[model samples]
Target: MTKVKIASTTDVSSDKVLKTSANGKSVLVAKVGDNYCAIANKCPHFGLPLAKGKFENGVITCPFHGSKFEICTGKNVEWVDSFVGIPLPAIAQKMIAMGKSPTDVANFAVTQEGTDLFIDS
Candidate 1:
Protein backbone atom coordinates (compact mmCIF):
# COMPACT_ATOMS: atom_id res chain seq x y z
CA MET A 1 0.00 0.00 0.00
CA THR A 2 1.18 3.49 -0.74
CA LYS A 3 1.18 5.59 2.39
CA VAL A 4 0.50 9.18 1.41
CA LYS A 5 0.98 11.89 3.94
CA ILE A 6 -2.18 13.98 4.06
CA ALA A 7 -1.90 16.27 7.05
CA SER A 8 -0.86 16.59 10.64
CA THR A 9 -3.16 15.41 13.39
CA THR A 10 -3.07 18.88 14.80
CA ASP A 11 -4.27 20.23 11.48
CA VAL A 12 -7.53 18.30 11.69
CA SER A 13 -9.62 18.86 14.75
CA SER A 14 -12.38 16.49 15.87
CA ASP A 15 -14.97 18.82 14.44
CA LYS A 16 -13.20 19.62 11.17
CA VAL A 17 -12.25 17.72 8.05
CA LEU A 18 -9.01 18.07 6.12
CA LYS A 19 -9.11 17.75 2.35
CA THR A 20 -6.14 16.33 0.50
CA SER A 21 -5.16 14.05 -2.35
CA ALA A 22 -3.51 10.65 -2.52
CA ASN A 23 -2.56 8.71 -5.63
CA GLY A 24 -4.53 11.15 -7.76
CA LYS A 25 -7.60 10.60 -5.60
CA SER A 26 -9.25 13.30 -3.56
CA VAL A 27 -9.33 12.31 0.12
CA LEU A 28 -11.02 13.66 3.22
CA VAL A 29 -9.39 13.11 6.57
CA ALA A 30 -11.20 13.66 9.83
CA LYS A 31 -10.63 12.86 13.44
CA VAL A 32 -13.24 11.10 15.57
CA GLY A 33 -12.22 11.24 19.16
CA ASP A 34 -8.79 9.58 19.24
CA ASN A 35 -9.12 7.80 15.90
CA TYR A 36 -8.66 9.20 12.45
CA CYS A 37 -10.53 8.24 9.26
CA ALA A 38 -9.89 8.75 5.55
CA ILE A 39 -12.49 8.56 2.81
CA ALA A 40 -13.11 9.79 -0.68
CA ASN A 41 -13.84 13.49 -0.76
CA LYS A 42 -16.39 13.07 -3.53
CA CYS A 43 -19.87 11.78 -2.94
CA PRO A 44 -20.52 8.59 -4.87
CA HIS A 45 -24.05 9.61 -5.81
CA PHE A 46 -23.20 12.77 -7.78
CA GLY A 47 -19.42 13.10 -7.53
CA LEU A 48 -19.87 16.26 -5.49
CA PRO A 49 -17.20 17.35 -3.05
CA LEU A 50 -18.17 16.09 0.40
CA ALA A 51 -16.14 18.81 2.06
CA LYS A 52 -19.08 21.12 1.48
CA GLY A 53 -21.43 18.61 3.07
CA LYS A 54 -22.44 18.26 6.68
CA PHE A 55 -20.57 15.95 9.03
CA GLU A 56 -22.29 14.92 12.20
CA ASN A 57 -21.88 12.02 14.60
CA GLY A 58 -20.09 9.58 12.30
CA VAL A 59 -22.03 10.32 9.17
CA ILE A 60 -21.52 12.85 6.36
CA THR A 61 -24.42 14.06 4.29
CA CYS A 62 -23.87 15.10 0.70
CA PRO A 63 -24.59 18.75 0.06
CA PHE A 64 -25.83 18.23 -3.47
CA HIS A 65 -28.03 15.14 -3.17
CA GLY A 66 -28.38 14.57 0.56
CA SER A 67 -26.90 11.09 0.39
CA LYS A 68 -25.56 10.09 3.78
CA PHE A 69 -22.42 8.05 4.38
CA GLU A 70 -20.55 6.73 7.33
CA ILE A 71 -17.29 8.61 7.61
CA CYS A 72 -15.13 5.86 9.02
CA THR A 73 -16.51 3.00 6.94
CA GLY A 74 -17.67 4.82 3.83
CA LYS A 75 -20.92 2.93 4.02
CA ASN A 76 -24.03 4.27 2.38
CA VAL A 77 -26.40 5.06 5.19
CA GLU A 78 -29.09 6.76 3.15
CA TRP A 79 -29.72 7.36 -0.51
CA VAL A 80 -30.60 10.65 -2.16
CA ASP A 81 -33.20 12.47 -0.13
CA SER A 82 -33.23 15.84 -1.90
CA PHE A 83 -31.11 18.57 -3.36
CA VAL A 84 -29.56 20.80 -0.74
CA GLY A 85 -32.00 20.75 2.21
CA ILE A 86 -35.23 20.40 0.28
CA PRO A 87 -37.19 17.29 1.10
CA LEU A 88 -37.95 14.92 -1.77
CA PRO A 89 -40.88 12.60 -2.03
CA ALA A 90 -40.47 8.89 -2.68
CA ILE A 91 -41.69 9.29 -6.22
CA ALA A 92 -39.19 12.03 -6.91
CA GLN A 93 -36.37 9.95 -5.52
CA LYS A 94 -37.32 7.06 -7.75
CA MET A 95 -37.59 9.32 -10.75
CA ILE A 96 -34.20 10.78 -10.03
CA ALA A 97 -32.60 7.37 -9.65
CA MET A 98 -34.27 5.92 -12.73
CA GLY A 99 -32.48 2.58 -12.63
CA LYS A 100 -29.42 3.52 -10.67
CA SER A 101 -28.76 2.61 -7.06
CA PRO A 102 -26.80 4.25 -4.32
CA THR A 103 -23.30 2.92 -3.76
CA ASP A 104 -20.82 3.15 -0.95
CA VAL A 105 -18.04 5.68 -1.13
CA ALA A 106 -14.40 4.64 -1.19
CA ASN A 107 -12.62 4.49 2.13
CA PHE A 108 -8.88 4.49 2.75
CA ALA A 109 -6.95 3.17 5.69
CA VAL A 110 -5.48 5.86 7.92
CA THR A 111 -2.42 5.76 10.09
CA GLN A 112 -0.71 8.25 12.30
CA GLU A 113 2.98 8.65 12.85
CA GLY A 114 3.88 11.08 15.55
CA THR A 115 1.72 14.06 14.64
CA ASP A 116 1.53 13.38 10.90
CA LEU A 117 -1.38 11.60 9.22
CA PHE A 118 -1.00 9.15 6.33
CA ILE A 119 -3.58 7.44 4.17
CA ASP A 120 -3.14 4.07 2.50
CA SER A 121 -4.11 4.37 -1.13
Candidate 2:
Protein backbone atom coordinates (compact mmCIF):
# COMPACT_ATOMS: atom_id res chain seq x y z
CA MET A 1 0.00 0.00 0.00
CA THR A 2 1.17 3.53 -0.72
CA LYS A 3 0.63 6.41 1.69
CA VAL A 4 -0.11 9.67 -0.02
CA LYS A 5 -0.35 13.01 1.67
CA ILE A 6 -3.64 14.53 0.61
CA ALA A 7 -4.20 17.61 2.76
CA SER A 8 -3.38 19.50 5.90
CA THR A 9 -5.40 18.90 9.04
CA THR A 10 -6.57 22.46 8.90
CA ASP A 11 -7.76 22.01 5.35
CA VAL A 12 -10.52 19.67 6.58
CA SER A 13 -12.87 21.20 9.09
CA SER A 14 -15.15 19.37 11.42
CA ASP A 15 -18.29 18.04 9.70
CA LYS A 16 -16.95 19.14 6.33
CA VAL A 17 -15.45 16.99 3.58
CA LEU A 18 -12.31 17.80 1.65
CA LYS A 19 -12.06 16.27 -1.81
CA THR A 20 -8.62 15.33 -3.12
CA SER A 21 -6.91 12.69 -5.21
CA ALA A 22 -4.25 10.27 -4.02
CA ASN A 23 -2.43 7.76 -6.16
CA GLY A 24 -4.81 8.65 -9.01
CA LYS A 25 -7.80 7.75 -6.85
CA SER A 26 -10.26 10.40 -5.83
CA VAL A 27 -10.63 10.60 -2.04
CA LEU A 28 -12.90 12.39 0.36
CA VAL A 29 -11.50 13.26 3.78
CA ALA A 30 -13.88 14.29 6.52
CA LYS A 31 -13.38 15.29 10.11
CA VAL A 32 -16.14 14.17 12.42
CA GLY A 33 -15.61 15.50 15.91
CA ASP A 34 -12.03 14.50 16.83
CA ASN A 35 -11.57 11.69 14.33
CA TYR A 36 -10.75 11.86 10.64
CA CYS A 37 -12.22 9.51 8.05
CA ALA A 38 -11.33 8.93 4.40
CA ILE A 39 -13.34 7.23 1.66
CA ALA A 40 -13.65 7.09 -2.10
CA ASN A 41 -15.06 10.26 -3.55
CA LYS A 42 -17.41 8.45 -5.90
CA CYS A 43 -20.80 7.02 -5.05
CA PRO A 44 -20.83 3.26 -5.40
CA HIS A 45 -24.33 3.17 -6.87
CA PHE A 46 -23.69 5.13 -10.07
CA GLY A 47 -20.06 6.22 -9.91
CA LEU A 48 -21.16 9.78 -9.29
CA PRO A 49 -18.79 12.15 -7.55
CA LEU A 50 -19.68 12.29 -3.85
CA ALA A 51 -18.13 15.70 -3.28
CA LYS A 52 -21.54 17.25 -3.86
CA GLY A 53 -23.27 14.90 -1.43
CA LYS A 54 -24.55 15.87 1.98
CA PHE A 55 -22.60 14.82 5.03
CA GLU A 56 -24.13 14.56 8.47
CA ASN A 57 -23.29 12.47 11.51
CA GLY A 58 -20.76 10.42 9.57
CA VAL A 59 -23.41 9.56 6.98
CA ILE A 60 -23.17 10.81 3.40
CA THR A 61 -26.25 10.95 1.17
CA CYS A 62 -25.45 10.70 -2.52
CA PRO A 63 -26.86 13.58 -4.51
CA PHE A 64 -27.75 11.59 -7.58
CA HIS A 65 -29.63 8.62 -6.18
CA GLY A 66 -29.98 9.26 -2.44
CA SER A 67 -27.81 6.36 -1.42
CA LYS A 68 -26.56 6.83 2.12
CA PHE A 69 -23.21 5.53 3.32
CA GLU A 70 -21.36 5.55 6.57
CA ILE A 71 -18.23 7.56 5.99
CA CYS A 72 -16.09 5.98 8.66
CA THR A 73 -16.86 2.39 7.76
CA GLY A 74 -17.93 2.77 4.13
CA LYS A 75 -21.02 0.72 4.86
CA ASN A 76 -24.19 1.08 2.92
CA VAL A 77 -26.81 2.73 5.08
CA GLU A 78 -29.57 3.26 2.53
CA TRP A 79 -29.92 2.54 -1.16
CA VAL A 80 -31.43 4.51 -4.04
CA ASP A 81 -33.82 6.82 -2.22
CA SER A 82 -32.88 10.03 -4.03
CA PHE A 83 -36.48 10.48 -5.06
CA VAL A 84 -36.80 12.82 -2.09
CA GLY A 85 -40.04 12.36 -0.14
CA ILE A 86 -41.52 10.05 -2.70
CA PRO A 87 -41.63 6.42 -1.65
CA LEU A 88 -40.83 3.92 -4.37
CA PRO A 89 -41.60 0.23 -4.49
CA ALA A 90 -38.88 -2.30 -3.83
CA ILE A 91 -38.90 -3.30 -7.47
CA ALA A 92 -38.56 0.28 -8.55
CA GLN A 93 -35.70 0.80 -6.14
CA LYS A 94 -34.00 -2.24 -7.53
CA MET A 95 -34.48 -0.87 -11.01
CA ILE A 96 -32.88 2.41 -9.99
CA ALA A 97 -29.78 0.44 -9.05
CA MET A 98 -29.45 -0.39 -12.75
CA GLY A 99 -29.27 -4.09 -11.94
CA LYS A 100 -26.42 -3.51 -9.51
CA SER A 101 -26.65 -4.37 -5.86
CA PRO A 102 -25.83 -2.05 -3.04
CA THR A 103 -22.13 -1.99 -2.21
CA ASP A 104 -19.91 -0.25 0.27
CA VAL A 105 -17.74 2.59 -0.82
CA ALA A 106 -14.00 2.06 -0.75
CA ASN A 107 -12.45 3.44 2.41
CA PHE A 108 -8.79 4.36 2.90
CA ALA A 109 -6.88 4.28 6.10
CA VAL A 110 -5.92 7.74 7.23
CA THR A 111 -3.02 8.76 9.39
CA GLN A 112 -2.03 12.13 10.68
CA GLU A 113 1.59 13.29 10.60
CA GLY A 114 2.03 16.62 12.31
CA THR A 115 -0.21 18.95 10.30
CA ASP A 116 -0.39 16.79 7.20
CA LEU A 117 -2.86 14.00 6.47
CA PHE A 118 -1.81 10.82 4.67
CA ILE A 119 -4.10 8.17 3.26
CA ASP A 120 -3.30 4.62 2.21
CA SER A 121 -4.88 3.96 -1.14
Candidate 3:
Protein backbone atom coordinates (compact mmCIF):
# COMPACT_ATOMS: atom_id res chain seq x y z
CA MET A 1 0.00 0.00 0.00
CA THR A 2 1.20 3.47 -0.80
CA LYS A 3 0.82 6.08 1.93
CA VAL A 4 -0.17 9.36 0.38
CA LYS A 5 0.01 12.51 2.42
CA ILE A 6 -3.34 14.24 2.41
CA ALA A 7 -3.48 16.99 5.00
CA SER A 8 -2.58 18.09 8.48
CA THR A 9 -4.74 17.25 11.44
CA THR A 10 -5.45 20.90 11.89
CA ASP A 11 -6.55 21.18 8.29
CA VAL A 12 -9.70 19.13 8.99
CA SER A 13 -12.09 19.63 11.86
CA SER A 14 -14.99 17.61 13.16
CA ASP A 15 -17.53 19.72 11.30
CA LYS A 16 -15.51 20.08 8.09
CA VAL A 17 -14.26 17.84 5.31
CA LEU A 18 -10.92 18.00 3.62
CA LYS A 19 -10.99 17.37 -0.12
CA THR A 20 -7.77 15.93 -1.47
CA SER A 21 -6.34 13.39 -3.88
CA ALA A 22 -4.45 10.21 -3.24
CA ASN A 23 -2.54 8.52 -6.01
CA GLY A 24 -4.57 10.36 -8.63
CA LYS A 25 -7.88 9.44 -7.01
CA SER A 26 -10.01 12.15 -5.51
CA VAL A 27 -10.96 11.61 -1.89
CA LEU A 28 -12.75 13.42 0.92
CA VAL A 29 -11.35 13.10 4.41
CA ALA A 30 -13.37 13.82 7.51
CA LYS A 31 -12.53 13.81 11.18
CA VAL A 32 -15.06 11.98 13.27
CA GLY A 33 -14.41 12.59 16.92
CA ASP A 34 -10.80 11.58 17.38
CA ASN A 35 -10.74 9.28 14.36
CA TYR A 36 -10.31 10.10 10.71
CA CYS A 37 -11.95 8.58 7.63
CA ALA A 38 -11.32 8.88 3.90
CA ILE A 39 -13.83 8.06 1.19
CA ALA A 40 -14.13 8.56 -2.55
CA ASN A 41 -15.18 12.10 -3.31
CA LYS A 42 -17.35 11.15 -6.26
CA CYS A 43 -20.93 10.07 -5.86
CA PRO A 44 -21.71 6.94 -7.85
CA HIS A 45 -25.20 8.13 -8.77
CA PHE A 46 -24.18 10.94 -11.15
CA GLY A 47 -20.38 10.91 -10.94
CA LEU A 48 -20.38 14.23 -9.14
CA PRO A 49 -18.17 15.32 -6.29
CA LEU A 50 -19.63 14.45 -2.88
CA ALA A 51 -17.87 17.28 -1.12
CA LYS A 52 -20.91 19.47 -1.76
CA GLY A 53 -23.23 16.98 -0.12
CA LYS A 54 -24.30 16.79 3.46
CA PHE A 55 -22.31 14.71 5.95
CA GLU A 56 -23.94 13.78 9.20
CA ASN A 57 -23.71 10.94 11.70
CA GLY A 58 -21.14 9.15 9.57
CA VAL A 59 -23.33 9.28 6.48
CA ILE A 60 -22.92 11.35 3.34
CA THR A 61 -25.93 12.11 1.17
CA CYS A 62 -25.51 12.73 -2.52
CA PRO A 63 -26.77 16.21 -3.37
CA PHE A 64 -28.04 15.44 -6.85
CA HIS A 65 -29.88 12.17 -6.20
CA GLY A 66 -30.02 11.93 -2.40
CA SER A 67 -28.18 8.63 -2.16
CA LYS A 68 -27.01 8.09 1.38
CA PHE A 69 -23.75 6.27 2.10
CA GLU A 70 -21.82 5.42 5.18
CA ILE A 71 -18.72 7.52 5.10
CA CYS A 72 -16.46 5.26 7.12
CA THR A 73 -17.43 1.84 5.80
CA GLY A 74 -18.46 2.89 2.30
CA LYS A 75 -21.80 1.19 2.65
CA ASN A 76 -24.92 2.19 0.80
CA VAL A 77 -27.63 3.26 3.21
CA GLU A 78 -30.18 4.32 0.66
CA TRP A 79 -30.43 4.48 -3.11
CA VAL A 80 -31.79 7.35 -5.09
CA ASP A 81 -34.74 8.59 -3.06
CA SER A 82 -34.94 12.22 -4.10
CA PHE A 83 -34.24 14.65 -6.89
CA VAL A 84 -32.12 17.64 -6.11
CA GLY A 85 -33.46 18.74 -2.71
CA ILE A 86 -37.02 17.57 -3.23
CA PRO A 87 -38.31 14.23 -2.02
CA LEU A 88 -39.52 11.88 -4.69
CA PRO A 89 -41.92 9.01 -4.75
CA ALA A 90 -40.59 5.47 -4.90
CA ILE A 91 -41.73 5.03 -8.45
CA ALA A 92 -40.13 8.26 -9.49
CA GLN A 93 -36.92 7.35 -7.75
CA LYS A 94 -36.69 4.07 -9.58
CA MET A 95 -37.32 5.76 -12.88
CA ILE A 96 -34.70 8.37 -12.23
CA ALA A 97 -32.14 5.81 -11.13
CA MET A 98 -32.00 4.46 -14.65
CA GLY A 99 -31.81 0.82 -13.57
CA LYS A 100 -28.57 1.39 -11.73
CA SER A 101 -28.18 -0.63 -8.56
CA PRO A 102 -27.06 0.93 -5.34
CA THR A 103 -23.30 0.80 -4.89
CA ASP A 104 -21.03 1.70 -2.03
CA VAL A 105 -18.51 4.42 -2.29
CA ALA A 106 -14.78 3.61 -2.08
CA ASN A 107 -13.02 4.01 1.24
CA PHE A 108 -9.34 4.27 2.11
CA ALA A 109 -7.57 3.54 5.33
CA VAL A 110 -6.48 6.68 7.07
CA THR A 111 -3.52 7.03 9.40
CA GLN A 112 -2.28 9.97 11.30
CA GLU A 113 1.40 10.54 12.01
CA GLY A 114 1.93 13.40 14.39
CA THR A 115 -0.10 16.25 12.88
CA ASP A 116 0.01 14.87 9.35
CA LEU A 117 -2.74 12.75 7.85
CA PHE A 118 -2.11 9.99 5.33
CA ILE A 119 -4.29 7.61 3.38
CA ASP A 120 -3.48 4.26 1.84
CA SER A 121 -4.14 4.07 -1.87
Q: Which stretches of candidate 1 lie over 4 Å from their true place?
A: none
**Whole-model lDDT values for every prediction:** 0.85, 0.85, 0.87
Weakest lDDT window of 10 consecutive positions for candidate 2: 81-90
Residue-level lDDT of model 3, residues 1-121, one tens digit each, is 8889998988887776778998899999888877898899988877888888888887888889999888788899999998887999999999989999999998888898999999888
Deviating ranges (above 4 Å) for candidate 3: none
Error of 1 at 26 (Å): 0.9
**Cα lDDT of model 1 by residue, 1-121, tens digit:** 7888998877887776778888888898888877899899988776879987888887888887788988899999999888787879998877765556989999987888999989877
Against the hidden reference, what TM-scores do the models get?
0.93, 0.90, 0.94
What lDDT score goes with residue 86 in model 1?
87
Least well predicted 10-residue stretch by lDDT in candidate 1: 91-100
- Model 2, range 1-121, lDDT digits (tens) per residue? 8889999988998777889999898999998778888999998887888888888998888887889888888999998975543656887888887888889999987899999999877
* Best-to-worst lDDT order: 3, 2, 1
Between candidates 2 and 3, name the one with more favorable TM-score.
3
Q: Number of clashes in every candidate structure? A: 0, 0, 0
* Ranked candidates, highest TM-score first: 3, 1, 2
